[model samples]
Target: MKDPKRADFRGPLVDRRALLVAGLAPLAFPGPARAEPSPAPFPFGVACGDPTSDGFVIWTRLALDPLAADGLGGLSAPTTVRWEIAADEAFRHIVLTGEATALSDNAHAVKIEVQGLAAGRPWWYRFMALGHRSAVGRAATAPDAGAATESLKLVAASCSHWETGYFSAYRHMAASDADLTLLLGDYIYEYSYVGERAAGRPRRHDRAADVVDLAGYRNRYGLYKTDPDLQALHAARPCVVTWDDHEVENDYGGLLSQDVAEDPGFPARRQAAYQAFFEHMPIRRASLSDPWRLYRRLAWGDLARIHVLDGRQYRSPAACATATSRRGSVVGDDCLERLQPERSMLGLTQEDWLYQGLGGPSARWTIIAQDLLAASIRQKGRNGVVGHWTDGWDGYPATRDRLLSAIRNSPAQNPVLLGGDIHSFWTTDLKADFADPESATVATEFVTGSITADPPPYAPFAEMLPENPHVKYFESRAHGFMSIAMTPDRMLTDYRAISDRRDPRATVSTLRTFAVESGRAGAVAA
Candidate 1:
């Protein structure tokens, strides 16, 4: 969450002048200093995401001096920009061209949601601002409505901790020809420590303790973008993203922080975090808001509908009374009580929208892209039985159960859930009650491990896997991502793991495969 508290580490600082300079760096520069312009914005390259049949959002940030330790360049003026979408890599024919403005107030970033395009078509685009050209990004429109499609593919990944490892998983994703990339949060971890910065790098802005202001948040993202592998992935294809706990504060809720003594100002902090997140991410203007509401639907023809959920914004507090508790049941009754039928992760209005949308669509697959596991997971510790991390969907059992019931009754062909946050891979049969060994599986879930965080070591949990028959697979010793394939008849998911997270050149391997057939919610080993 914030690098687990350590005495050696100092908190972030709050300075208005420093923040203003960092936020205004792009506008201060006049034009490309050289005759031959750079091919693209070096570190914070170009990308696209949240696509629909008619339109999609394009993204790029101006980084005149990315290596600046404070992550703040000296540009303070607004820059007029131009972009083009072409049919080929060589830009033989430019299909779409328009003007965009990058302002200091928004950290010199631009998100253009272009419309009036054909479905299921491949397109290439790039950006130009202050004489600088961004890398050419490749993106595709969604398939035609109700058209019979053979297959759809996507790369799923999460948790890219800068200190833990390199983003080799992104390299693998770039190699695969995926329709889109699904990022399940932890995009940036708010941490500051000695011996953690790379060689020749200076310490950037600190958060006083954790991310509280816009500059702290911006600096964190800047640090993450410095990774070449991540930049490669962004340059390669579009990505669909959702935030997890670490994006704001670990185990935070509406107005509560994990530490009682600390004043988190969660709602205000959440607002700032949301603003920073929108300014930096490749999200559509429609999805942008003051508090950044991220629940929405993405339709791929009539073959599938993806329901993306925001878990941290409206969730209840953790179940365990104290953060240091070792009790098996981390979810406390106080937390569970608020998860009544009316309580919502996407809020009441969004829940109704999802339910109505599901009933209207008859897709081959209905997938929920969420931040944490939806399936019930009960672990047996040395003392007794324990439930899931209080921060996950398991913390609100009632809400999860109701959602599952809705899926079961809906007309959707197959219901599947994709989750991240837990730094270990898991495949579970989403049953009404996992405690009952014979509970019927109502949906299938695939939980991808962190992209870089160390997995919880294989301990007694390894020996207890057999006791939980509903869990078909489990791996707690690797850091990587998941690759998923969807068809009319079956949904196939491969758990891809890296040889070693610590190794920058680690090779990725497919550790296991699971499939869910049409009309069936449970997963079977492949």
Candidate 2:
């Protein structure tokens, strides 16, 4: 067993690039296997994620055919896979390497968490399985606790529905020079592609219906991973992921599914989707054991702290879920059930955990990387009366209050919410009371738009923003992601969009920019 107290495993080693650059002896890799492995085995490519001060997780699945009917990736038996982490882009200076099993039960997937490395430095890694070599990927260890830095860059994105359009947005995100990528949710849509061409849909599923069982969910994930653009992003940077609905089913909340009534078999389906999520993601084993409790915190030295929340897993049913109406797409005082204090979006355990993180002082920037909007976004208002769509934090009024109150009373600095799932960009101030126009700002929020998925109709939102003063910036025509830069005193966000999500050759451009200065409550033009 490794001693838990070991600092690092550095040793006298040659850098991978040094051999070519310095004209030194070439470092030998593992000798050839009995049979040369083909690139087909690593079809989904390699990914790195969940980075920490000492280490991060590297992931890849051995797949002969990614879209196999069984979603098994064509591996029927256990296979041995080799992994290595190097200090530089070249593998000459190897730090950690070992053998791991890619088991059939685990979808022939391999996730190796490499540790005992130098902190706050970039590292490169690759995989070898079945005699084939995987592509190189980059990841980094977080700065040591209390470590200070002038700037840290991370990209925020979400909602990539395959059939909506080409993933040109993701292609652009892969080129960005950032430290980490955050895939907020809707990593893969559960529904199959079978709509009218007249509807303006861009693509269709290869061979699948709506995902239900483990095989279905696994296949869906595999199909989405097959996209070259999506694969490139996963390979470029370590992604931090959290799922919203659609990963399982539309509007699913714990045991209850959206657009449908709770069924006796919903729990079984949830378990299946939960397992597939683990098999594909670079998440640690602890997260896989309980999908309902994925809320966790990560710190980037003293620069920033990230708290990612699983909003759909344990949230109470939508506020206006009625026998006939089923879902509350839009409503007003008629949805009185929304006023209950016990109606929670984060549930009890996650709520307490988040409150504790907010109440502490550890980082200069306190960020909540969540799966849905938290502001009081409402529509259909007239004569000082307004209504809300009961899917977001607006439905859980009391829940929102508790969270905002915690921020108000906490020692947390520059609390900002980074959110997705709305399919539009929104910059809003989290207020203590939405009804009271003079309410104090407790936090700031920046909501990113869907990468390629269709956004909501713009006219209604355009009409609604005038009634909602807290919403500082709103745009629905964009199909792209947010690039954010953080410092001790300010955060700069770029709302990027592509001209044509339908065109594979589309170019990405910034639509607008906003800056949140430390001690200021809302974003301002930068």
Candidate 3:
């Protein structure tokens, strides 16, 4: 029997007796850090992300009016912003301080990369500008590259639509004892309205139409950032983020738009969206030089190595895409075009880099974080034909095979894949050959559900489960996040479910728990 008191990540992995374990500390800031002033200079709050052993990037935008019509955060002239990092919540034990200029060119956002700090320790930070002080944010650096550590705790979430519901998942994450947070993708949606009942939405979007230019994209991000729960989540834990299709357009691939006729204008629009994303996110400043580059790796001592991937920027047009129809479609499994070896998902350069890293010196655990599901979900299509979704890995069979082969042949140990953008929870065994149900399982996969977005109809998806033996579990009727705790011996994953998205103070419970023992390539119910 499972111990109910120690079910959640906070209760078991983080001990209440001794809150601070080595460099990992619980979410405990001073009282002032929890409150944000209305219509204040830093209304959007503060964030820190992209952590390294030395230091991490800290961010804050001077937005007295975040929803301004011009998308400038209501700042006309450049302002100098000061930042400080301290060992304690108060500024008495200051370790580092610096000044940065927030200008209209970058939407009045100040992002600083602080170096020379102690590795693997917690730091408290805050900003000052426009005669007002921002909320104090808590951040932590990574453990040294190859150092041995006891365990790592992580929280993962994605697919947040502002008009659909509230962000209670982010609120709960802010109060947890997680060392790092992973935002897989779909951080913001382009459309002002999605699906039916647009007029009766729980919340209204900031724009009246779909976003097209830099101004529109910046405003969309501003609208999402202004949410109190999202702000609190950023202020609580450091996040590592990447983008999916909704950041540009629905189901778009590379330079192609949803419809082929709009391909002519897709380039300019994509460039604008990329620029806006960089300006608002807590990513490194070095990424601005080559905005298209996002795939990177981070090491968590000898316990784990996280390989973050970019799946949208360099993918080929969806297989069998037509000029008059959709960008991605459900095609029969017999479709020959999707099986072509030339159809690349991560493009050539990214594929080479990933293959090289997968074969490098081994870590105790290898975690691959990307934007979409890597497992096959074949189902019955119209006219009694088996089909696959062309927008995901099912469309590029050759690419998936090569990736699985590399993992099977590499020295990496206990590989596990993490994904989002499906708006549903899933646990599957990644087999060397998905076509053969009895084939060897090479790795395990866990795809998180949406934070607030609507899920696809559950009945239809549930009916197709028997055909997929590799899929261990599936659930589509909830809104929440995943809590993962990894040790050298085993990995424990909890599928946390929120009771209600419409409620501001919704309660979260563990809907299910699964465990994968060391050297095991499949998840078993715990």
Candidate 4:
């Protein structure tokens, strides 16, 4: 890429090192096809994520037809690709260059974790393969640890179920000037649409069988990757990601399936989903062989620290699940299992790690970037119902209390949480005890709605807010991402919502704005 003529080449450019992995293609899946291949294989586009102070990951997939039926992405052979990271969009100052193998075993995807560069700066990257070059993408590195950080602008998004709506939210996000994006899971849904929902489906899976196996999961991911808005979001910013239940099976816990506790195939299916997610995403060294990992931390100098927590893989099973009827969603007095003290969401080890991270007065902004929420939301009728939601932190009250106590006991300055998964915007004051209105407000939780998934009903959730005083704001009817702009003094959160999900030319506007002042725990209107 040093040559001016080669640098001027637009479209896809396969790296020279791709050939090294190319010769060994036969050892991978799909074997080596003698048949002629397509000229351009970047069907799924390019992405970058999991950034650090020194480096970040770049990703691309070789797919002739992203929605191909067999979920092979029309790849009959392994392919080679080259990647480069530049200081500018014009590729003037090339920093890192490398080759990666797009193996069929990984669904023809390539992920190269590039390192050893300056921190807190913007970078551009692209992929080349088969004489064609993929589109250019932008990513940013975290600032050096213990260094002075003035401000950070981040975009938070989640719960993008493909069939429900269009991804205009992602399009808007991709066009934004945010430094990074955080995808709070539900990246892909595992259920098939039926009845009227199927009739009005915006998109359909390649093969809609609820994704039980490897092929099914791969096809599902391929189907979602075909969206231009989603692709643009991936290309526009480096992201910190963690998974929730929808990526595997709906409402699934660590050691148990959503319903039946002893489904032997659940682990294999989950492993396939995990592998497929790792293949598609630009995450670095994500564990597919383990069940209890993916919880880690990323720092942005002394200004901010992001704790990406995985609440799905280590949590105890939902309360009140039984054979023949395993509905563990609703809260009620009948479910004694929900109040078990041993129930955990982040498991014991991860919980302790999180506590330690929040124990000290370190970064000016200690942001908890997790998938599930911690607010105590209840449903209400004329009697004002108070149900214990076992799916989120409300289900594991003991652990939630422990975390809140840690934040309160710690000398940390500004403790804030950016969360997604409920598919509705929320600005709640996180307290140690939901029952005690006078309990100290330990920290703040700002939850964003879905990118394209269906908007949740507003009225019922609205009724419950009166009883739950800790909730400062709530909106259940919207589809968009949240933008968080944080400085050392205060963090401002804007709930950016799109006008319509189906419209290709939808406009984005802020639904509300909330701010948590530095040295303060609760959030107030900005």
* Tens digit per residue, CA lDDT, model 3, 1-526: 9755324312122123433212332242233322333337987889999887767888888887788888897889999776777666664456555567889998998888765566677778898786678888998878878888889899999899998889989999888899999999999999887557686678889977999998899999998998999999999978998889999999888888888788899999999899888888888744556666888888888888988988988887788777564556678966888999988888977898898999876678999999988999886655566688888888888888889999998988999999999899999999998889999999999989999999977887799999899999999999899899999999999998899887878999998888988898999999
For every model shown, what is its TM-score relative to the native structure? 0.86, 0.91, 0.91, 0.89
> Compared with the true structure, what per-residue lDDT tens digits does model 2 show for residues 1-526?
8743233544433333322211122224543323343557888888999887777888999998787878898779899787777766766556666677888897998887766666787888888877778877888888877787778888889999888788888888899998889999989888765646326677786554677888888988898888889889998888888988878887777688665655568889999998899899988655456644567888889999888888887788887776633454666877788889988988888899899988775688998999888898878633445688687788788888999999888889899999999899989888888877689888999999998877988887898787799988999988899999998989999999988878887899998899999988889888
lDDT winner, 1 or 2:
2
Ranking by lDDT: 3, 2, 4, 1
After superposition, which runs of candidate 2 have C-alpha atoms over 4 Å from their true positions?
Answer: 1-38, 197-200, 259-262, 287-292, 381-386
The CA lDDT of each predicted structure is 0.72, 0.81, 0.84, 0.79
The candidate maximizing lDDT is: 3
TM-score of 4: 0.89
Q: For model 2, which pairs clash?
A: 14-92, 14-93, 16-90, 16-92
Error of 1 at 477 (Å): 0.8
Question: Candidate 3 versus the native: TM-score?
Answer: 0.91
Which ranges of candidate 3 are over 4 A from the true structure? 1-39, 194-196, 285-289, 381-385
Query: For candidate 1, lDDT tens digit of each residue in 98-164?
Result: 6677777877777887665666767787787766777778977787778777788989988877766
Find the 10 residues in a row with the least total lDDT in model 4: 24-33
Q: Which pairs clash inside model 3?
A: none
